[model samples]
Target chain A: MQQMNQILRRIPVWAVYLIGALPAPWLFYQGLTGGLGVNPIEALEHRYGELALQLLIGVLALSPLRRFLGLNLLKFRRALGVLTFTYVTLHLLVWLVLDVQVPSQIWADIVKRPYITVGMAAFALMLPLAVTSNNLSVRKLGPRWRSLQRLVFPAAILGGLHYVILAKGFQVEPLVYLSAIVVLLMLRMPISGVLTRTRQADST
Target chain B: GVGLAGMAQGAAAQETLEPNTWEEITSYNNFYEFGTGKDDPAKYAGALTTEPWSVKIDGLVDNPGDYDFKDIMSEMTVEERIYRFRCVEAWSMVIPWNGFELADLLNMAGVQEGAKFVAFETALIPDEMPGVRYPILEWPYREGLRLDEAMHPLTIMATGIYDRPIPNQNGAPLRLVVPWKYGFKSIKSIVRITVTDVEPPTSWNMSNPREYGFYSNVNPNVNHPRWSQASEREIGGGLFAKRIPTLMFNGYEKEVAGLYEGMDLSQYY
Candidate 1:
């Protein structure tokens, strides 16, 4: 814990921002320049999806890190969450621009294609959470703020489901994401094993 | 002129393989890369390395031998034709493929009388293609065709696409593209083509034999238990258009469906 805290302190906030945002432009550059070579659009979609999913995972990991590692670095969560939304938005944009140029087709894709439907559902769920994540909304919502923000958990779950539904087979990769969400959600539950561990720790 | 050469090759290849439309040719795909997505081949296959490669031809062929990938390319004139690559997953693509007829290559291999099936293997190095490393299925990659299907005119020894040598990700060097069958039946980065009496197991079919079959002829009536094959989305054609009705034998029914006239495709599919 001490070592992690030390490393965290040494790492400048600017470094994290730069590191996180670095790929955004680089991927964008790839898209603009046609660096994807043979299958440019697919390459764009694949990278955008991967980045969005990773950001979602990062958001899920935040709380566990705070509790287990004593890293109360709460300030980064909002930015992290925003970055996740940004990538998801880009993923959608790329799909719209490259794959679905027509509005009717876009609507049809949302209606058809189970994977696309799940992804659209997750994206829609994320919008409210992203909007409510601001301090202004939190202040406006008051005690209701926490309840509103808690939607992120479900949003993340749906995002993961969207990914799993698109994967080739029900292999272990998707299962890992599902497991992580389960752990994160369990950490929030009052009656879970994590609560038992915390209670035992306090007594000790 | 290159145009004349291409036209001549296209003409010869047509009798030997499925002649494709420009839309069908450009939008089609092979499932060797991008893990079975119709759009995946256009993107991920660029990472494939096709040059300086060799194909190991084995099994029951009388003229079993290994040849340089380029040697084969030189032996056959590469012709560009558009093919509608219909995936079993219901999505489709019109791909412009550059290669020669599979019949020409099969005749060169000199199959033995008893050889009833032609099983082909893809060069699936798990380290290179991380997707293969996953325990997704029993084997790395595999595809096969019954003897008559193997000898069919539409089967082509494909190497290049988009008017150039195929980008590595699309199966550089050489691969088999069976236009009428679903994309998976069109084996990519072919390391070997084996003639065998025993029905060789295919990657998807082996993973789920009932879902995939040895004679995976393109038929709309026969649906993959997992998804309907009755309709297909022509990839890169545009997102606006919904899936079109899949034709029996991928529109080569006039010539090939007679081969399976009485045979129940649903049972065989």
Candidate 2:
């Protein structure tokens, strides 16, 4: 585990960001070249959204990995979160400019559709977290910065819910994503309580 | 002279009808019996055996029997129909379907006095259709229409697209095509068609009554629960193509509006 952490530390965070951002252009190019099948707009939109969800799941998995397995990926969390937001933005753009394309309908969907409403809310929650994901804000806000970053918990849940509600029929894929997010959040709970109790015992 | 004038008008209309390519028509499909994904049917439906197919025509009809595909094709007058195909998911396509009027087939069986609705069902081969094995939707995908809607000239039992026999993915052998309604109403790979008084249980409507209504006519004013139906993305339109405003009854308001003259479309939708 120590060796693995050492290896992960050597890998630059910018490399993570670059690797994560690669799919966006590649997917767009695929859509342009007709490689995304018949309905490229829908395919591209779904792919971007799914990638965002996968990245969100990765972000959620980080704390649990460090807590249980002691495999610290804390260095890359910001990069992962930023990349997740980037994919989410791309997903929204694909829907707005390519998929939906109408000005009024775009606003109407965000207001009207429950799934879209949830998705936009999730995106809105990420805004401040994304803005403050820097060294200056981390130093200025101190402990409060950690509390603000915890908004990702609800944001991730909402993201999963958005997918679950958006799917046609009772699809298992969306349910699987939602369940994974819930489980990851649950895993963060008991270990923290145990650590607190252990520290109190040591003080006594 | 009137017939000649009508034929001339039809030819003029045909000139405006831009049918999607054979590849587009075949590849992009919503046959949930094959699978839910747009390309799932194209990937998996090749295993389906459509040859020597038969349609079991039953319920309130004078003659009820399993009619062979060859016999039905031989009996009917096949013609080309170019239609605006609209899906409930807010996608549109122009398709050139080759088939005969559904009314001709229904009439051949001799509709009984009690027959008020026409219910259709798709073939459910579990071994061949990998999708049916999972309960994505109630298997043997079902759909129905009012007797009048069934009798409409625009409603057809399509066998071919682009003048060739339909590929398995696009509902091979036989399929329903009701141009005015959402594409799900046009059930694919039909196996049974029943003439009955009661409104039949449609697969999507049965799955979610709030979202999918039985009378799923194309209405721009009526929004789907998840998305706005006011506009549609044209299927063949590339990534940068603009969305077009969806038309009332999918631009067949002139032909089909009379069928729902007094009824509320939004409520029905």
Candidate 3:
């Protein structure tokens, strides 16, 4: 166990992010190769889109979890966020190129459909977060790093709302992600006698 | 002496204006004001003001009266009709509708001269309806039919379905039934029926003219801007993509196409 701990301690953060994402590409490739049996196309799109939102919410919960639960799992949040962008890109590519063969229709759908508009907005917000997750970029910006990373909360809410309205029903599976995000947000609220030092600094 | 016989002939013709094949009438509907989904209108329409219902008969009707909802349904015996409902959105349902022909009630109300168009409106009530909370669609749904279309043998006012009083969800008290057209053409929970000289504004056409039109017939040839109309999936089927070919006038070409003589359906659509 001690040897294992030593090995893990020496592994670079970037290397952990790369190694952790090994399963995503395999799942994507399996979908591409027609592994999903019925409604393979729709199933492929659902899996990628669903995972993107799940990982996004997971990343949003990290900092708060570390502070309250005394768990520092946020070490993996940067990697998970970048992984979300990768899956979102794949989802958008499959939908734009495969489902809507007509280019004009795709353009029209993005503009006309409310669900698509919010979905695109969520993806746009992720681009910057993924880019700045690295230590080098975070160090370069200093204080601005915290502000930029804070966007994950709203982005997560938008992604959840997008899926909810598009579904048009209270589907149990997708509702789980929405409920999780809500609980995570609720966890961050300052209960009685439990204010953070940052809150005190801002007040001054 | 010739005047007496002329009155008798007119009465005979009016009596047969109602349908012999009720199946063709009940399966058709106009629940699309709720959503494009086949089950949505029925599920959403339950909140409509079905209780304490009254319809105003005005404009070119001689005996206009505030008819009680139940009294109007009791005007004729209910017939059972099992039909395949086709939607403009490319979905379908096989429903057993129980109701009477609309022409019988219209003639009883005494339609007068120059009654060329039959315009209808849903009882607009926002208080009970949760869907109205959001402006997902225009309120007080409207639909219209030409004079001949209104008097056609296939036109009906459905009161029940699946051998029971029409469920509140499926336009409880009274719902229009016009076979040969897509289901949305059949308006539900009607509050007013106006017999006028000109065509009136329909809900879908007024909201999205490019997507829906006034004379929205069931023609597989004309595709909706968002979806293909050539095929439809039956309700209660699993998520398989299997679809059946849609028929022109929903398989009522023998009775209806003769009415629109020489007009271009594609243009009107």
Candidate 4:
């Protein structure tokens, strides 16, 4: 366990980027080869959305995993954040270019449909975090950088909410993911002060 | 036309309908009685016993009894009718169905006076159907059509596809095929048919009346509240293919337009 943690700590962020990129080629191969059964466009959109949500949840879970379990995955959190944004952007593009296929209708759907509205809101929230997720911004902004990054929590919540609303009828899977995010947020509230102290120590 | 006359017209029917493969039809389906997933029906519907099927015809009809499957087949003349099947989800497919007109089946039972509507019921085998385990919809999926609509030549009781018996997942033995209305209106695996003076309560309308109406005619103008009805994707029309504009009454407007001439479709819908 100690050796594993040491390896995780020492691992390059580029490795994370490479590992995160593995699914894209596989998905593209499936899409091009007609492996995505029946409706490949819909399948691609759903998968990218799911991957984005999963990575967002992973980003939310990082602090709790480090604080409680004495295991740290903090170094890769920025990479995870950027990868989540990449997936979300891909998901949106697929919906725009492949599924709806009309600029006017796409704008109408984003504005009119509650599910799309929430999903777009979630994607919009992730934008600032993705932009400022760098060492230069961290050094320049200092304490404000952490505050700006807190958007991840709301982004995660909205992402989960988007999934819940998109489901046709009563579905348990999205609810389960939403509940997990809620619990993670609740777990986060009590240790907020401790989080600041740990961060200060890391910077020193 | 009956028997050999209907069989001889198969070539003419093939010309109008764009053919879909049996693989495409079998794989992609929405039989919610089995499950909500598109592929769920095929995986779980093998448990359904289709051979010993009997449909109970009741209500205002003169002949009210459990009609055997074999008897129903022997009495009616089956024909291949190529139809455009549109779902409420805004996806569609062209299917070549083999069955007799639903009016012929009603005529066999002798439609009594004052029968305004024809109500149909799906088989309620809780053991065979996983979806029945949930209250996502009321058990024994029910759908109905106006007597005039039911008697239309386009309304058929499908038993076969591509010269073979329909797979259990695709509503085997007997299923209603109303080409003009949304696909769900054509209730699958029908176990009961009732003629009534009043409109029957359909499953989707009862589940959520706002989104789903009793008369789910395909209209591009009237949106589905959540999604646009302006266009639809054909199932076998390729992954990246553009969605074509949806037609009024799914292109059967000429045949069915006269039925609802006096009534307000927007209000009724």
Best of the candidates, DockQ: 2
lDDT, residue A128, candidate 2? 95
Worst 10-residue stretch by lDDT in candidate 2 chain A? A191-200
Q: lDDT per residue, candidate 1, A116-199, as tens digits?
A: 888898899889987887778988999998787787888888887877766654366676776777777777676655766876
- Score candidate 3 by DockQ: 0.06
Winning candidate number (lDDT)? 2
RMSD values, in order shown: 6.8, 2.7, 10.5, 4.2
| DockQ comparisons of all candidates to the true complex | 0.10, 0.72, 0.06, 0.47
Model 2 stretches astray by more than 4 angstroms: A191-204, B1-11
Q: What is candidate 3's lDDT per residue for B83-128, written digit by digit as tens?
A: 4567675666655677887788788788899789999887777665
Full-model lDDT for every candidate: 0.71, 0.90, 0.70, 0.86
Error of 2 at B225 (Å): 1.8
Cand. 2 Cα-lDDT: 0.90
C-alpha RMSD between model 4 and the true structure: 4.2
Runs of candidate 4 with Cα error greater than 4 angstroms are A1-4, A10-12, A191-204, B1-14
The residue-by-residue lDDT of candidate 3 on A59-121, one tens digit each, is: 777777656444566567667788888878878886675444457656766776677878888
* Per-residue error (Å), model 2, residue A39: 1.7
Residue A90, candidate 2: Cα error in Å is: 1.1
Candidate 2 has a TM-score of: 0.95
| Residue B193's lDDT in candidate 3 | 91
A1-204, model 4: which lDDT tens digit per residue?
A: 577799897889899999997997789678767687676777788899889888888988888887767678988888998999999999999889989998899989988888899999998998998888888999999999999988888988999999998776565668888998888888788477577678778879
Model 4 has an lDDT value of 0.86
> Where does candidate 4 chain A have its weakest 10-residue lDDT segment?
A165-174
**Pairs clashing within candidate 3:** B29-B183, B30-B186
Candidate number that wins on DockQ, 2 or 3: 2
